[model samples]
Target: MFGKLYLIPVDLGHPSFEALFPTLNREITSTLTHFVVENQKSARRSLKLIFPEIKQGELSLLTLDKNTSELDLNPALDWLKSGKNVGVVSEAGVPSIADPGSLMVKLAHAQNIEVIPLIGPCSIFLALSASGLSGQSFVFHGYIPIDKAEKTRFIKEMEKATGRNQAQIFMETPYRNNQMLEDLLSVCKEDTLLCIACDLTLPNQYIKTQTIGKWKKLKTEDLHKRPCIFILGN
Candidate 1:
């Protein structure tokens, strides 16, 4: 029988993995000798933080990022084929959700390897739940365009879509967060409700929902280079 593929979630810019990852997840992650990771260096740091007892020497990590080719995954697939359980660890939060690792999951399914997702914090879901937005019908646009005109057009469309009782959820590169907020404030209507969820699950965690007009009027937190989730709702 082919070994199972476990989807493991890690901390989101915080070392408090104890609060986010459950015991089952820690147990599974600790037992795994093979892993497909976005960044091996960061993954090792996260592993040390989450499970200090984990033997780093025993681990075999394969790089699986945007540039990783289908041919690059042959070794990992071979490991699974040899009845060795492999874990998929993301840079932060859950794997394959606005993050890398989807291709491996798709291949594992095709190869009939059981895919098991261990419970952990998902920033998007946590933000939406706290944002008081329409979670029943929401869309997550991974990252908005870099060009100003394109982003403005994107946010305008998302706001228009939000008019239909749907919430538009999206993120920006940490450093570009403040700039994106400025665009939202400039392009969106004054009455359009905006939710800025920043530094989720951290001591300085900030999650607030306010009108674009109100947001402009208030002195906001330092979102520059902070991991954030921006949601547009009714």
Candidate 2:
């Protein structure tokens, strides 16, 4: 029998994993010896936190990021075929959702390998749950375009989609968060509602929904360098 692939989720900047993840998640993650991760350092650090007694050298890790080649992932599948369960974890939040682990999961399905997703906090879902927007019909545009003209066009389109009762969600790099917010306020209508979920699941977390006009007047000092999720709604 082939071993299963476990989709593990990590905390989103929370001081302790216990705060966002259940004990069962930690238990399952600790038992796995093989893992495919986005960043080796963060992955190893997370594993050490979950299993304090784990020997760093004993754990096998495979890097899977935007640059990882399809051919390079074959080794992970080989491990699973050899009856060794492999875990997939991202830098934060759940794997394969707006992350690079989807390729591995897709391959697992093709090879008839069982893929099991363990429960944990996902920032996107967490933001949507508290946004008070149209949860039934929503779209998540991973990241906005970097070009000024393209970003403006994208924002306007999302606003139009939101007007039709569909929530439009997106994110940006932490350092560029302020720039994204500026473009949002400048391009979106004054009355359009926008939700900003920042530092999710962390000690200094902040989530608020307000009109673009209202947001324009407030100082966004806190969101300057924080990871955030932005949701646009009517």
Q: TM per model?
A: 0.97, 0.96
Candidate achieving the largest lDDT: 1
| Predicted structure 2: lDDT | 0.90
RMSD of 2: 1.1
Which ten contiguous residues of candidate 1 have the minimum total lDDT? 17-26
Residue-wise lDDT of candidate 2 within 29-59, one digit each (tens)? 7788999999999988877766677778998
**Deviation in angstroms for 157 in model 2?**
0.5
TM-score for candidate 1, residues paired by index: 0.97
Q: Give the CA lDDT, 0 to 100, for residue 183 in model 1.
A: 90
lDDT of each: 0.92, 0.90
Candidate 1 per-residue lDDT, tens place, 1-234, comes to 799999988898778766888887777777888999999999999888778899999899999999999899999999999999999999998999989999999999999999999888889999999999898899999898898888889989999999998999999999988888989999999999999999898889999999999999999898998899999999
